[model samples]
Target: MPLRDLLLGLFVIAIWALNIIVIKVGVEELPPLLITTIRFMLVAALLVPFYPVARAQLPFLLLLSVTFGSLHFALLFIGLEHAEAGTGALLVQMGTPFATLLAVVFFKERLGPKRIVGLLLSFAGIAVIAGGPTLPSPLPLTILLLSALGWAISQLLIKRGPPIAPLALAGWVALFAVPQVALGSWLFESGQWQAIKQASWVGWGAIIYTAVMSSIVAYGIWYTLLRRHPINRVIPMTLLTPVFAVGLGALLMGDSLGIHKLIGGGLVVSGIALIVIKFRRAPRLA
Candidate 1:
């Protein structure tokens, strides 16, 4: 990668890392699913007008809406609402292994010894973290794991489905996902009108940051890099995201990194590193 593009990739990672902190703050003031609904609505509104969609991709978009936009973010934001930003960041790393497993099962891909060890280590790391005191409860961790699985599934779908422009994919998925997420908010959540009325500038700013910077700007740069560069070169750099997220969570949200977190997080990251080090990459989380 050229130096400028490398920096741009790092910039995208930085935006993604900080996004965890923003979502942490946003969920404190608003319902998690509600935040997803609003954030994606803004994302769609921003990008849909700029990109034309093909009718053939419409079915794929609907499926992606469920896996990527709705299930992924709905569970993620909900889990992050009660979980530490850093921990949530770490746990979501499971998406790598989750994707690997899916590929092996569905695509009949073969994993070498390294990947097997990596998978075991990743699960062991989650097990270690499950025993840690950092998490408020098992529920958030469980929810976050589900979110990661949704994300992994989405990756496979995108890889198999007809090719679409990155921004168009983002836009159409968000467009289709809005109603699914909105239904969740409407069903399980209350006082949305009151919450929207009462939310401060901080809450709304967090939403804007997520929709614009994290969703559009960051992804635009990232997809450009992937298109212009080799997958191996661009992929390894993404390992920095969780590391950056953890540090930013400490600095911005005053998240504590306990011994348990250190050990568990290390295992999880190392496991993910082992998985991603050799093989490939993706467009990143939605």
Candidate 2:
């Protein structure tokens, strides 16, 4: 890969990694659901203008929106309200492992021994993280895990659904997500009116970062790179996202890293690496 593209890829990862922090900050200021509602609203307003989905794809698109947009982000932001940003980021990595397992069951896909190990290793790490006696209320952790599963389910829906442009799918998800998320915010959360009225720049900045940088710009660059490069070359770079997030959380947000977290996080990232990166055989000699 060229240095320029490498830097660009890192830039996208940085945007996504920083997004964890932004989300943590945003949830601190405004209700998590409200922040999610606003983010989806902005995303829809911007992308739906340029990218439109086909009528045939609407039903599947709506399902995707429900899982990818509402369930995932709703639970994620809400979970992060009480969890550490770094820890939440680490837990979100479970989405890949969850997706793999769901694929095995739902799509009748096969997993090799290595992937099986990866799956076990990842979940064991989660157990370790949550096993600590000092662990807070299990509610946030459970919500985070469910959020990851929702994301995994969304990926499955995308694969099962009709072929649609990535950004177009994202736009439609954002557009449809607006009502679902807004309704949740209205029903479960209070003080939405006051949150919008009194929020500082951090809260609103989180909205812009998530809607524009994380959703659109980061994904735009990502798919462009995927088209130009091999999946192996591009996909492995994603492993760095959590690494960056952990560091940023500690440095920027002062997220505490307990001993259990250090061990558990290492296992999680290592397991994800095993699951995601294919170890190719050496070239054969004649």
Worst 10 residues of 1 by lDDT: 277-286
Each prediction's TM-score versus the true structure: 0.95, 0.97
User: Which pairs clash in model 2?
Assistant: none
Residue range 1-286, candidate 2, lDDT tens digits: 8998899999999999999999999999999989999998898888898987778889888989889998798899998899888889988889999999999998899999999889988988888878753344789888888899999999888888798998998889988999998999899999999989999998899999999999999999999999989898999899889889988999999888788888888888888888999999999999
Clashing pairs in model 1, backbone N/Cα/C closer than 3 A = none
Which residues of candidate 1, in runs, are more than 4 Å off? 279-286
Per-residue lDDT for 1-286 in model 1, tens only?
6899999999999999999999999999999999999999999999999998888889989999999997788899999998999999988889999999999999999999999999999988888877888775878888999999999999999999998999999999999999999999999999999999999999999999999999899999998899899888898888888889999998988999888888888898888888888754677888
Task: Tally clashing residue pairs in candidate 1.
Answer: 0
Where model 2 places Cα greater than 4 Å from the true spot, the runs are 133-136
Sliding window of 10 residues with minimal summed lDDT for model 2: 129-138
